[model samples]
Target: MAYQPPVRDHLFLLRDVLEIDRYSNLPAFADASMDVVEQIITEAAKFTGEVLAPLNSVGDKHGCTWNPDFTVTPPPGFKEAYKQLCEGGWTGLGSDPAYGGQGLPHVVNLSFSEMSSSANMAFSMYPGLAHGAYSAIHTGGTDEQKQTYLPKMVTGEWTGTMNLTEPQCGTDLGMLRTKAVPQADGSYRITGQKIWISAGEHDMSDNIVHLVLARIEGAPAGVKGISLFIVPKFFPNADGSVGARNEGVKCVGLEEKMGIHGNATCVMQYEDAVGYLIGEENSGLKLMFVMMNEARLGVGLQGVAQGEAAYQAARDFAKDRLQGRSLTGPKNPDGPADPIIVHPDVRRMLLDSRAVIEGGRAFLFWTALHGDLMHQHPDEAVRQKAGDYMGLLTPVLKGYLTDKGFKACVDGMQVHGGSGFTEHFPASQYLRDCRIALIYEGTNGIQALDLVGRKLASSGGRAVMSWFAEIDAFVEANSADEKLKPFIEGLAGAKAQQQDATMWLMQNGLANPDNAGAASTDYMHLFGLTGLAYMWALMAKVSLAKIAAGDTDPFYENKLVVGRYYLERVLPETAAHLAKLKTGSATMMALPAEAF
Candidate 1:
């Protein structure tokens, strides 16, 4: 089955739920009226469906070819598809207009991103990584640096990659052995071997700009000593044209990954590659987070995208594939056997995927709107609040979504049975592609830790408190609505569980950090369930209003049904998470090294 972008859902979220048009006062939204946004999404859907979806299995089969000359040839059709992507100006949709971009809202760009990832996750990495790099430079780069690189990057004439993990360092940048020595020309000589550098040496673009993190000579040890440098594969001249090859920047080898095979995950060798400083020296960790946070959100979207694609494949198969008879009786009496869709268990699987995926979509879009407000809103207090909300929810979006996304993919595969295990169906491919989302952009465990340890206490818990208050206000406002009783009740219960868990962590984690570490994952999920429940309540509220206003659209009706299903079937997981969180770390750390 061809992948279908969920354009209707996006529209529902944008217009009815988020009401992005209300922000027309922001510069980015000046041209993003509903009609314009709808047209853009429609075109994006057509492009992804026509150009990228078919190439998904093609790329997976052939993968990228690495040559002895340190260059990479992407799977066939990728270069052409990428060319189309650039020509369509999709790469610069959310970029600054001063540098040849469309300057659309980040939420709009994210919706398109979800579609692209669903079509071809491997192919999407080329531009996705470029976008992140563009953001880093646009945020932290000097004026000269931005003028030189941002335009080309925005145009997709030159691609970009980030180099952080080395042979000895994965998440711990303090242990990185990569070194950068300052030179006479105010540049740095960066010498390092970075591992797992995606889009490191691909031939799809004119030049590859690398954002590298390295420790300058004689700097203080650990993460504080690190700095970011702009290390390109080829130097750019005064005219912004490709110049001499930066010596020692080479792709030594590619990592044979479990999935996303078309993307070149390269072992990059940088030996005295010329690099320019980005932002202030020894402040690389602080600045690198700008890129990391963006990438993390993108990874979360990757989870949703893969789950959407997998669910479509599964749902279509269930509706058509003939199998065992229905328990209630033969709905398809004329056929040999009723389609598997008649089975309760199968419906359960489908609904599980649907509930999580749709809820996650709302969560992502809501957070993205907060991101836009944080960046573009004129009001300082509003920006600060938006930023805090983003901080509080980033972990849930990344950790919870991907964790559930992988499970959703597995459920999709389970729906396929034997065919799912083989490559004959796309279900397995989606499963493979989604597995990485959980591990990258900081593992889900790390995300959980960050949520409990840092974000929970950020601004003295202002963000979390505000989040609880928002839910409280909603529940209180809807208490009189009989149509919303079930949803309100379920959401209220989940919110209370979340608050209790938060308070427990606050009380217990202060005495022993391990309690926080042990409870982090569950707390994150508990927080996630509460978040999704809140989304469902909001969605259900809008849906009820629409139905009350005499709108007979099945879309609104289906929204209410799905929201109900989530509240009844999925949101109950909050209890389990809360129970586990209350268990603390006593037994988890009881074992000694010798016992293992």
Candidate 2:
């Protein structure tokens, strides 16, 4: 089966479970009635299913080609598909109306992102990077810079990229050798080589926006000296039209990636390129963090989106491909063999994937709602709490979802049996494509460290404290609901261990910092488990209420079953994470170099 948009599930989560209409008083929600949201999602489904899904295999087969004239050609039909995407206004669904976007609530626009990502992972990255660049300038760019770049970017007329990586730097920006020289016209001349730049040289737009980070000549060493600059591929004319080529930048080469071949991962060279400063001097890192944080959330979504794609393919195969007879009896008595879906093992993989994908969607949307509230809520307290949740949960969403989501894709391949090993099956493509989510936007290991090292202590520990209080309130409010008691108990049990782990880290981590380092991954994952359990609980509550009101839709009943499966089969792994994290750094750090 082709990757159809999971529109039914998205609607159930947004309109029913989240009940976004309850926030109709907020600016973003004022126009986001379920009717409007449904219309947008329906159209997006049609666009992605028809325009993008057919290109996945074509992209994987042909990949992107680096041309002689310093331009890279995308896979077959990508240029035309991108034109349709731009014209449809799908790129700016969540952006501000002031900059030519649809001005919908982010959670609503997120449905399109998830759908497009599942339909075409490789093609999705081109616009994905542009959104990150748009957000950076959106929040930090000066008014003129916004007017110069935002309109075209929101309309997908021009694409964008973040230039931070170098031959020497991936995560460590301190040692970067890129330099910016101040010039007579107040424009700095940027000179550097940036590697692994996605959408760096694709022939899909009028001009490319390069958000470069460089150290000014004679500035202080390390990250403190860094600054952000706007260096477009072509200068804008007096009427905001594309002008002369800057003639100082070029795509030297492209990386042949393991997957996502549809996106041009270019190695860029800058030789005295005209650059405009953004924000305050020596504060680029601070500004870039806004873009990185948002990109990290998108990366997490990509993981689950790939899982959804793989799971759908596997689900279709299991139903149609006949296999050995059912051990108990012949469900297909007239046929010589039963469908593999009739077997318990096949059910395990399919159900496990379903549970992860659905629960993951609930978690993503739940977090994204807070992203909307963070900026638009009326009360300062609500805004602060929302902001804190966004910060605290970003890494959890990135690290945990990618870990499990990739595994789900692998399980999808296993479900396809030998066919999955070959390139003909989409399962192979899904698994390969899913692998990069673990490494980019900072590896999963770095995400864990950021969680334990940075976020937990931010704002005098307000973020984590706020998260705990909210989860506690949820559990207390629903403890007496007999039908939801198991979910509540599951959430409570996992959360209690998380609280315990937090207490241990507080007592032990500061004194022996390695304790935190060693326990970081498990703690982050435990946080993931607890967070998903809470999402499942919220979904269960909504489904139960629907069933109570005499809504006989089997969707709600299936929701309850999946939620139960999550709580019973999947959630118990938290115990191991908690146990392993509490072990600290002693045995973990004892091994000497070359011991292996």
Candidate 3:
């Protein structure tokens, strides 16, 4: 099945749910009128559905072949599709205006990215990495670096890569051994090997700029000593054009991964490569965090996009495929069989996927709004609060959304029966592609740790309390909304469980550190589901109001139905997570060390 962009629902979320109409009046967003936003969404939907998605399955099946010359060629049409994406200016949608960017809102850029990634994730990573690199440079690079590099990157004339992982250390950056030596000409000589570098080597653009993390000689050990360097495939001269080729950057080989085969994940080798410091020496990790935070949100969106796309495919299939008779006895009297969608069990799967897809969509964009608020809010306190909330939610976005999104994809594929498992259908590829989301950009396990060990105690618990207070305010404001009663009640129950879990973790920390670690994953997931439920309820309230007012779109009514399904079924999973959290470290760590 070809990809279809959820442009209508995306516009509804922005215009109605989040109310970006207010942004239209803001000085920073004055250029983004509602009409333009709608136009962008419409065009984006066409590009993704028509151009990128067709290559998805072929990319996965053919993968990329590495030649003996060490050059990489992507699956057929990927190059042409990438050129189309770059030419369309989708690559630099949210970059800085001074650097030739359109200076669009991050939320708008995120919406476009969702459609692109949903259509073809592997194909999208090339520009995705470029966006991260542009963000890093804009946030931390010197003015000269910005002037020299940003425009080219923003124009999609060049692409970018973030090289942090080595064979020995993927998540644990403290174990990184890449080194940088101060060169006589105000540059540094970087030497290291990075593994699993996505978009590390591709011919889709003229140059590939690498933002690498390496330690300076005599620097302190661990993450603090790490410094960021801009190492390009070919260094540019003072005239703003490509110069001599850098000698050390090499693609030793590529990772043979299960999905996203069109993206070349290379094992990069850098031997005394000339590098320019991005920020002050030994401040690389801190600067890199900015990029990591952005990418984590992107990864979260990837999860939901795939989930929603898979759901669409499944729903279409279920509505057409004829199967066993309905339990209500011959609902389709004209034929020997009934549409599989007639079964309650099939509806259960379909509804479950829809619930997560819709609910997850709201939560994902809500989180992106926090990203917007983090930067755009003028008040210091407001920006700080938004940033803190963002920090607190980042782990949840990475861990919970991706986890649930992958499950939704699986459920969506299941709704297709035996056909879902076969190579002829794209469901298997969707499942494979979505699976990597759980492992990269800090594994769900690592995200869980960040939530329990770091974020829960952020600002001495002020962040958590403030966030809960906001939810409480929302619940209080809508308590009288008759249609939202069930959702509001579910939120309250989940909130209580979350509070209890938090308190237990705090109390148990002194006596048993392992307790927090053991309960962390479940606790994080529980928080995400509850949080999504609250957002979904908020969306449903608005949607229900529209329906009551005789809103015309079938989309609005679908939102209401899906919102109810989420409240009824998906929200109940929090109970299982809560049960696990209540168990603490006991069941998780009961076995002896020698048991294995």
- To one decimal, what is the Cα RMSD in angstroms of model 3 from the true structure? 1.4
Model 3 per-residue lDDT tens digits across residues 1-596: 57789888899888889887786645446777778889988999999989998888889998887767667888899899888887898877777777778878888888999999999999988899888998899999999999989999998888998999998998989999999999889999999999999998877788889999999999999998999999999888798788888988888898999888989999899999999999898999988887898889889888988888888888889888999999989778898799998999989987887787778778878878777777887778878888888999889988988998898889988988899999888888889999999988999999999999999997898888887888788889888977788878888877887887888889985478898898899899888988888888878888888988988878877787788788777888888987777777877688998995
TM-score of each: 0.99, 0.99, 0.98
Off-target runs (Cα >4 Å) in candidate 1 are: none
Ordered by lDDT, highest first, the candidates read 1, 2, 3
TM-score of predicted structure 1: 0.99
TM-score of 3: 0.98
* lDDT, candidate 2, 270-322, per-residue tens: 99999999998999999899889988999999989999999999999999989
Candidate 1 positional error at 343, Å: 0.5
lDDT of 1 at 96: 97
- The residue ranges of model 2 lying beyond 4 angstroms of the native Cα positions read none
Of 1 and 2, the candidate ranking higher by lDDT: 1
